[model samples]
Target chain A: MLVEKSAAELSELLSGGEVSAVEIAREYLDRIESINPSINAYITVDGERALEEAAESDGRRAKGEALSAFDGVPVAIKDNICTKGLRTTCGSLALGDFVPSYDATAYRKLREQGFVTLGKTNMDEFAMGSTTETSHFGVTRNPHNTDRVPGGSSGGSAAAVSALLAPLALGSDTGGSIRQPASFCGVVGIKPTYGRVSRFGLVSFASSLDQIGVFGRSVDDTALMLGAISGGDSADSTSIERPVDFAPGGLDGEVRGMVIGLPGEYFHGVAPCVKDAVMKVAGELEKRGAKIEPISLKYTEYAIPIFYLIATAEASSNLARYDGIAYGYRPSGAESLSELYLRARSESFGKEVKRRIILGTYALSSGYYDAYYLKALKGRTLVIDDFNKAFDKVDCILSPVATGTAFAIGEKVNDPLAMYISDLLTISANLAAIPGMSVPIGLDEAGLPIGLQIMAGHFEEKKILNCAKAIESFVEPLRPPL
Target chain B: MSTMDEKQILRVARLARLDLSEQEMSEYARQLNDILAYVRKIEEMETANVRPTDHIVDLHNVFREDRVQSSPGAEALRAIAPRFEDGHVVVPIIIEGQE
Candidate 1:
């Protein structure tokens, strides 16, 4: 029953004087305090700050002033996004004590919209792992089954929302980080078209593919938060100048003539249960009068390799700044500069991060650059071409968000190959820079949630949202485990 | 590809700035070689005609004006450093063969 209420509904109650913002914040904070102990979803909680913000929201409501949808909504931010004066550790010991002096563009935008900060959620160390076990802090357990993992590196954010710790949360998707976790956690997660949301404040993981996304219990809530926080900012040159659309009126199920493409490549290697769930949802949409057809993304298998090459190369270059100097953990008793850097990074970064860093450095290093990095870049063009060809045939592509339901925490940890394979379905969208969302369809036999992913061409978020809205109407809204 | 020699392992370790102990070097060489062998499967897939992509989206020149903006100033910079000495971050000598 606690998970049934949407963020908008709670905001309405607070605005109508039916309940105070303080009460709403308290309810969520208490839930998080109790549930998060088991999940390790949040690394830090600003309980006092949240209470103060809620009281202030109540004070404003008392004057009969209208408030934004997010005015009093308690939301969690991924620790990777810089929040002024808060510990912005990207789940790495390298940034253990680092507090940013300025806020990231996304964080500043959220604060400007009157969103109450619940706290900073956890993530993989430097956003490198499929499971959050790579976090320097600790593993973020799945909300449904504590023994299992909530897919990551955005696992903490997804788990927080799934556990009802926060009604909505922010996550960054690079090669399916957001959508995969959302699929695992059974929540609605939206990774807007690349450049749909600015990346000004998010700590760099892979600059080109990194995007700030939102996780909500429902489609409308996700759209509402996304619309408020998205738009061009001067601070981020990559931020696009797109018009904001928050109206939920047109999102009702009315897809009488929309073209839906079911990419054949996405079904390869997908588990039977997950495939059945996706096809069942597609069938429901077909009955509703939408056109669904099988389409081909010829170069789909190349996505993972291309993603690793490009992401690692860029990550290696970006992470070069964390050389035990400016703003992060530094080792003690290093008599030399090289020793300072080697010792600091070796001790601070988790194994996964170090692995990728080494891989990336090798890829971009002299002699290997042409064979690895350049070759991957060319393969990337073909991947984009695949999406371009598919989109020309249909307005959007419907696929499974991940290959399967949530797996146990240690299931894929030792086998990095198995872990990388989880991103098989979702990585293509990031490579294409298209808008994609993971909508919870149903739970598997193990009581784990499965998500059906919908992807649209670049800057065509409206089409993606409309299709997701139609699906949301037919399927029951997913409830959090708590 | 399944194994690397001790000399090759040491060379790569130095390149990665990892001063591995003699025992650790051999172990890492074995591990890295195994991982590389696994990843090299991509080389088998024919990509002769495919052009590589640098970015997923057609986003280009996402540039901000080259206007010089003021930072948090020296105080904030000093606050972030692990060891600051008179506006400069103190670190051990890096130049080789000089100290």
Candidate 2:
């Protein structure tokens, strides 16, 4: 029961002394011990360090020196975010032994409030894939079905939170890494507006599109975690200063007289089950005094290709740093540095990673620059322009996070394009640099969870979270049959 | 229609500093060609004069005082290196005749 409570409920108990931080942490750790074996959600579960941190938090509370409401809550972090003295593999053998010397600004900010990290969750190698299957550690299964994949690069974080292994989790979204997995896992996940959260220590997959975000069972808890970790840091030039209080008015579900847009492109060719679930939620919102109207975002079809081209291009450049010299897995007995670089990367990098690097290298290559990379960049401008126009009229856009629910493992793994298309509805947010979130709406014919996506314009965290809270109120929260 | 043959995949792999086996070469070539065919869909959208967005933040040329900020020290930095010497990383020679 302690493990099932949300971070908000746990915080209240912590304040009331009904529970000690250590007991709550230990309960979750015990659950992780039992459940994580079947799910494979975490690559590293640091129980000793977590218990020690929880004890320190308890000590702070006894002395009346508690920093924030989330002081003693246990949380899981995606492996890509750098944790000092903790291994940050980014789900690749390339950095299997790499330990960060510095803490990511977001992680440091969480520590400011005494959040205990349960472990480093697994992910797609370098956040390249849509399913957690690409992780060198192992695939993270959907908590609802053992045969299904928890959607990824942030799949492990989402799965851990969904299975009650932790109250909350942090994830990075480079083209739907956080929101899609959050959908697949039947939890709430958010990708804040670009430059909203500092990316100083979060490992970069695609510099322009990557943003750090949070996952929770409820909207307010996710917003609270987002508020604590958000703010401008000089270390990350892209980070923009914004008001950190994201849960403005406590997500009171006040959508009266609000206009919600349902982009036609998102629902046009989607599966009946996914469309019905999203429309049912939208219809409920409309009945509650919000107006739902049709809107067209013509560039929606281009998101997958543009995202693939731009993201892989940035990834190729970002991952070039793992050359065996400055900390990463290096091979033995190399005759020259070229051989060393080749061997280190060739030996350690996964198939997806190499594919991305080659795609990126090719896109940015001399003859293809104007055609692939530059064309995607220009096409991205249209995508942004499309969202900019729509946000002027609608408070937020409602859509399905993916075309369908979580698919069986290995269903789309070998086919890279199919997996890339899994993120069509979500990738536009990253391209447009807008805030987007996924909250559980209902389920498909199969017993799996389906998530409804909410999107708002640039730096509109309050709008999106408020909308998510509204949806959260309408839908009866569904839990995985554990 | 867009495709990368084996020679092109190998060339790009070399540029990416990755050495591929014979199996990998053919595999990457096919996969890359398939992805490229999909990528070619972007060419369908014409943006003759549209400016490409490299970074979404509108702030250009953010300037701060050029102060020497403290960094994670040399010891901490060297600790994660696969092979290191006296305050230096050991790497195979990159230049000719250096070995």
Candidate 3:
């Protein structure tokens, strides 16, 4: 089935004239149609537009005008990433009818590379929640078990790739949004180092920590998409001016004599099966001539608070732009301007988003600034230092991506604190502004996916991708029981 | 060490421009206190002499040569506005419409 082929495999077929882009797009769109009802992975499926783009790709390839190596491959985009003229609701009622006038740089780059745009995938409203239950659209279910949640705020993107609704997807990560979902859904998800991908039209959640990354069935697919979107964009001053380094040298799994650090802190509360699965990979890598050693990121425990404090503060500042006045949901019959701003946000934003905005505002408030946000900043410095020290002794750090596998849909939804812990294990990477990825390690005792996170030092995506590629050789690419 | 109460939450919601319902304010207050209690762990560390890191990768002022860039255009901007008239975003008059 074309829907079952890896993006790279599909590209090879397209290049060989064995299959047409239209056929590939139609197959995936049909798969999305049939399967997405159970999964709720996509918030919007632009089948007509997707077919048109695929046909254009076919035309280009027929005339030797293909845009890039993986031209005509379909990709799902997380809803928050702006696509001009497309409703970029961000899974919130505030922008339910809002459309961007310009495309996000990452999406624009994908289009330039001849990627057939599938549609926008669902995410948490303003990416405030972890399980995507907070999306105004609905919850995206785990393909392995319909009862469990697909992690969020990139849940839909991960779910899309996991269920084979799309071969590849683009997701933004802030405090484990990408990796956590990737782990829960049993797919390859990467959150590149901060500033690796431009955030030009990506609705900002946490400017300092947010990054756009790729999700794929295979590590190479994600690597190729990451390489395509990475590099300097004048539109985003934070976009690093560096050459793309993580492009697919497919199946390059050599890891001889590599030093891998196992942080003792990350495994503390992880489920036994997850720990066993991660340790099994360490054993396999050791047998392959890679050295594994125990290391301490003493500041690991502080990452959650630091990440939330900084991220929410930035989000409160970022989301303040969505006043009722210029281009967004405006309340009717409001007597005052403040009421317009207040009602527009309070009525439109979900509970989680409100909680975050309030907490963030409190953090940045007059007396609490030093005690909360500033303290978090100083604490973040120590976390960065801890990772720097750890990376000095090892090529990369390995750990479980979460405490356990996917939880039930409503398990942590009501308990905000418990939901925040879903991101605990993965937020340290965002805190340090480093590259991290979740590669499906194996199934848990309950048969849900448990992903092993491989994090590398800043700008060192190559190391983690290589290590994940090696791990993939051991576990093979995971397939959920869709 | 401060736990949020409804009054404080109300002030914060006001500052955040959120018109929280009474029930939401109480619920948010409790939730914020719970989260605040958890994040209070940041107080455990001694942060003296530690420089704050706002940006992970050290970036200096990036100066680009001054040049004209195309705007998205007023018409395009107005098209998405919730209430637009006379090619401008329409909102209630600020000073005159106080409650």
Candidate 4:
């Protein structure tokens, strides 16, 4: 029943006096109270604060003072984003008790727009894993199937939105963190062009690749939320200063003259069912007056190896700041400085975190830097070049977000290599620093969701959104599992 | 292929500030070698004349105005510390006379 209402629909209902903000918040809170215990989607819920904000929003509306369209709309934020006075744990025990003193630029912008904060959602520890299973706080289960993991890092945000606990949620994607989870949970998630949204509040996973994205039930709703949160902020050095137009007017399903590319390499290793669903979407777009062409991104095969080296190198450098000296948990009974760091990190970080740190340190180590780190950086350039070439021929690239549907919770966790490959189709976008989104297309035989990823050139989010909206209109929004 | 040895694992662990037990060191060496072997596949690709990309976007020198800005003061910094004394976070002494 909740599948019928979009964020805009719910907002209109609240504004038109059909329902009050307090009642809306209560309904979602009630839903969370009923469903969250099973999915583990939300790590923290601010019921009291949310209701207080709702009451205030209701008062404003009563006096004929209207806020933004999203005003009084309930939303969830990923735990990695800093919210002043809230526990902004990146789902790691290290930052479990760390409370941010200042709001991340994105949080401030959302709050200023009058959106009610529901609470922080869970994620992979330090936003390091492809599956939410790496979260220090237990794994977030998929709303579709309890046995499978909601895809990760932003898995909690996607699952929460999918389960209707929140109308919209924020997630950060460094390498498929947002899109992969969106695919798994059967929702729409967009990883904006890097620098499109400010990264001030998001804990750094891989600086160049990390971008704050949003999860919503529909493309238009996702666009509305993205529009509100997208502009540049000086607080984050990497935030873009370009103008952004996220109006839902473009959702009219018109893609005339738009060239959508099907990269031959992206489809090479994909599962048959997944490839069938994605190609069906491409075929649908072609039917809607869009030109679909086969394009070659020759360097596509090198995406995963290049991604790990660069991301791990950046992660190693960025995570070095989490020493026990500053905030984050510090282990007791340390006899020496070395022991202090060793114990704190060992106890605080999960296996994936340690694995990445080791890999990064080794890559960036003096002797191997040229062979591994530097070469990977060059390979990254080739990947970007490949995208640039494709864009010259087409406005956007369409592919499956992942090679396959969501796997069971423990399916790939023990096999790190297999888990790493889960990000195959998505890593190139991050590597090339372009905008990419995962829009749910159809469910597999097991009833698991499969997402069709659409990517665009840097700062060309409008074009990507146009193409995505065109596809989304054809394949109706998926209904959530009860 | 560059094979990782115990000494190399200890050296890397030390640089990474990870104090791995003897058992963990051997285990990590095995896992790390497997991972590196996978990464080694990139060596076969011909990237002879490719340029290295440090960042995806061509942004350079994104400098802000040089002016003093307000940040969370020492109080906030102190709040983060597990223990503090004399306006400093207290940590175990590893290097003698450093504190």
Candidate 5:
């Protein structure tokens, strides 16, 4: 059951001298060899490299030169986040052969602390879809229910952690890619405040909304991974120079006199089970010396539009670098530069990606710029103003991560609007540039996992993390029957 | 507002450098129109006085001292390229084209 241990627990075992890092890596690799085929959690498993890294970690430990607390723990990276010398396909055939020559700042920081990487996990094509179905590699199944999607575009990372393939995994959230999947998989996931983490090596899906986050079975483990990967990077200009210490002792799990806002807007269309689960947790928090109050964010409905406009516009521009001549797959038999670019991009990108790119291009094109993109930008300010005003009355806001639990894999794939609506509750935080985290509350009637989302103002991760920790302490960890 | 039509879709696709088949173009036209219809709701909101929020964080010029740092050289960079010649990336010839 070494694979079943949390990152924090694995770190403890390694520091206690009870197990070597190589053995831990080997155990997870063996589990991946057995389980990965069924769930499709990982797109690539670099067992040899992971073992080598684990051996080095063991060497460091024996020499008493322990780098960081989570050293020796194996973690999976979402395919979109680049890992040096490793194939970092963002789940599209276009970049299927694209091996990065540099590590993402988040992964680099983790490697510097001696964490072994267990290869890249699958994702929606370029992180564009809410369901992992858009991935050219294939969809990642939910560990709870094989027929259900694990939720995306970080489905593989969430599934890997849910199935105990890795105790900790790195995911990037653009329009709820991380939190939605974490909710679906019944794991803890965090999307730090905008500019909280560096995005230097992350393949841009939506540059403004994209953020690298961590997935773990527990909040403490997620916090440890967050702490390890956070800090400003010169490579990323938007990265904020903020102090981050997500260590266990950093938070005291206190909720006394804390005001938790229950946003009425987020509950309007949510499933009864999901709303009940969150309300149940809200009741628990109220009893534990926290005040729960009903709050309204009237502009909540505009988040999806704002997010789509901004995310797609950014994506269209960002993905322009994937021309045929660049470092990725190229279609042969192109006689002209225009033909080459067109064929390469069209053939490489998936349906969802193509749709977004076209939408974005049109939104930014002549005659539509002011009506669509610019209008969303102006509305974005109102959304941010809503959050700023709400924060003045509350410490953190509680909501459901998604409308419900994981749906059948192919259920919403063809219905693009339904897939887009999956991120409705979670997109507001991204639009407002605030920190958000999803903690598992419990399950519904069908036995699918449900997550309660906690949101805090800009750079107020400590508040949300503390609230998440309080919820973590109150609820029992729900393990999927993988 | 006008729904997305085939002509508009083709124009955007050309701008985006995506070569779509007739079948794919029609499919995208429908999907894009559906999405635009949903996103069009934002136009109803009044925001004449609100400032456009571009970057989430209020960060201005962040300067770093100019210093040479080790990087993956040109050879390494070219290694991942689909078509690479002697220290340069090979590509198709560029020309003005008639549609």
Candidate 6:
């Protein structure tokens, strides 16, 4: 199946004349039609539009005008990222009809390189949940097991790639939204260092924490995509002014003398299978001449609380713009302006979103701000210091991506605290504003996928990608039995 | 950590511009209390002298040339609005008893 091939392999086929761009686009669209009903990974399938774009890609290739290596390749995008003329609901009814007039910079960059967008995939409402169950469209079931969830709010992107619906996809990570799902689905996901990518058309979940990233079947493919979408954008002032060079060829199979650190705090209380899976990957790298050492990130225990406080506060401020006065759904028969705003938000936002909004309002309210919000901000500094201290001893950090494999869909949906803890291992990287990724290492006892997280210091993406590539070469990649 | 009650939940919901039913207010009050109980552990840490880190990236004032540039036309902008009238967005009254 063309859809089963890695993005690099697909690029090779397109360039080698083994397949046409239109054929590749049609193959993925057809797969989405047949398989999407089971997993519900995608909310919209723009078959006609995709084919039209594919035809343009073919014309470009024939005229010797191909843009990049990923020209004519098909990719999926999370719904939170806007697309022109496409209904990009962020898995919520509030945006069920909100089509943007512009495209997200990440997707626009890929589109300029002639990448065919498969469709906008499903996600948690406003990218707020750990499990895809909160999605207004439906829960995106894990391809590995139908009864289990694909961790979210990038669950649909992860499941789409896992089920061979698309070779590559784009996802947004606020608090492990990207890596957790990628781990559950056994795909390679990269959340670049903050400011590495522009946030122009991405709907803000938590502005300080949210970053757009890529999910591919291999590190090489992810690196290629990152190179294409990275760099400064004039529209986004927060985007760093720097050269965007991924040097995809640098993912050589040599890890000799590379230092990998395993944080002692991350290993505590992780499921035995998940811990063992990471250890096995570490042992393989050790044989490849990479030194593995145990280090301390003592503030690891406070990461979850810090993340929740800061993230929810930012979410409250960012989400205040969705008052149905501009672009989203607005209810009728409001006697007053306040009533209209209240009804629109209360009616449209899902349970989790409302909960976060209320929490955020309380955190920022008078008298409580010092104890909750300010304290968390100071703790965030300590968290960053911990990472800085550890990076002095090692090139990258390795740990389990999640506590365990994909859980049954409703197991933790009703239990909010347990669901929040699921992001315990992955949020530290985000809070520290460093680059972190999940690469599939092996499967657990129940035939579910386990992922090892590779994290590096700020703007040290190349180092982590190299480490992930080495681990990929050493471990047998697990394919979901779809 | 302070326990949240229905009145507190309503206050926050009103501040957030969300209209919650009595049932939902009570439910949210319960959940928010539980979540805050967990989050209060950070207060125990001695962060007295540490400065708050708002953004992780070192930021400078980014400026662009103050030259006029064309943007997507108002027609395109109005097309995204749910209710557009006479070249402007139609909205409900902002102030009571104002025409």
Candidate 1 vs candidate 3, lDDT winner? 3
Error of 1 at B31 (Å): 4.8
**What C-alpha lDDT, on a 0 to 100 scale, does residue A252 get in candidate 1?**
67
Q: How large a fraction of the reference contact set does each model reproduce?
A: 0.56, 0.88, 0.88, 0.66, 0.93, 0.79
**Model 5 C-alpha lDDT per residue in residues A201-256, reported as the tens digit of each score:** 99987888889999998888898889888999999999988887557789888898
> Residue A458 of model 2: what lDDT?
84
* DockQ for each model: 0.51, 0.79, 0.82, 0.66, 0.78, 0.78
List the candidate 2 regions with Cα displacement exceeding 4 Å: B96-99
lDDT of 2 by residue, A1-482 (tens): 89888888999999888899999989999999999999999999889999999999999999989888788999999999999888999999999998899899999999999999899999999998999999999999999898999999899999999998888999999889899999998999999999989999999999999999999988988988999889888999999998765663466777888899999999877889989989888888889889898999999888889999999999999999989888989999988888898899999999999989999999999998988888999999999999989988999999999999998999999988788877888999999999999999888889889988999988887878877888888788896558
Candidate 4 chain A minimal-lDDT segment of 10 residues: A1-10
lDDT of 3 at A172: 91
Candidate 2 vs 4: which has more DockQ: 2
Model 6: DockQ vs. true structure = 0.78
Off by over 4 Å in 4: A1-4, B85-88, B93-99
Q: Per-residue lDDT of B1-99 in model 4, one digit per residue for the tens?
A: 497888887888778887777667777778778778888877976778987886666678788788998888888888767888888878788678874
lDDT of candidates 1 onward, in order: 0.83, 0.90, 0.90, 0.86, 0.90, 0.90
Instruction: Please report how far candidate 2 places residue B30 from its true position, in Å.
Output: 1.7
How is the predicted docking of candidate 6 categorized under the CAPRI scheme? medium
Best candidate according to DockQ: 3
Runs of candidate 1 exceeding 4 Å displacement: A1-4, A64-67, B1-10, B20-31, B44-51, B59-68, B93-99
lDDT (10s digit) by residue, model 6, range A127-242:
99988999989899999999999999899999998999998899999989999999999999999999999999999999989999999888999999888889888888888856
Q: Which regions in candidate 3 have their CA more than 4 angstroms from the true location?
A: B97-99
Query: For residue B11, what is the lDDT in candidate 2?
Result: 87
Task: List candidate 6 segments past 4 Å from native.
Answer: none
Q: DockQ: which is higher, 1 or 5?
A: 5
**Whole-model lDDT, candidate 6?**
0.90
Ten residues in sequence with the least summed lDDT for candidate 1 chain A: A245-254
Count of steric clashes across candidates, in order: 9, 0, 0, 0, 0, 0
Clash pairs, candidate 5, are none
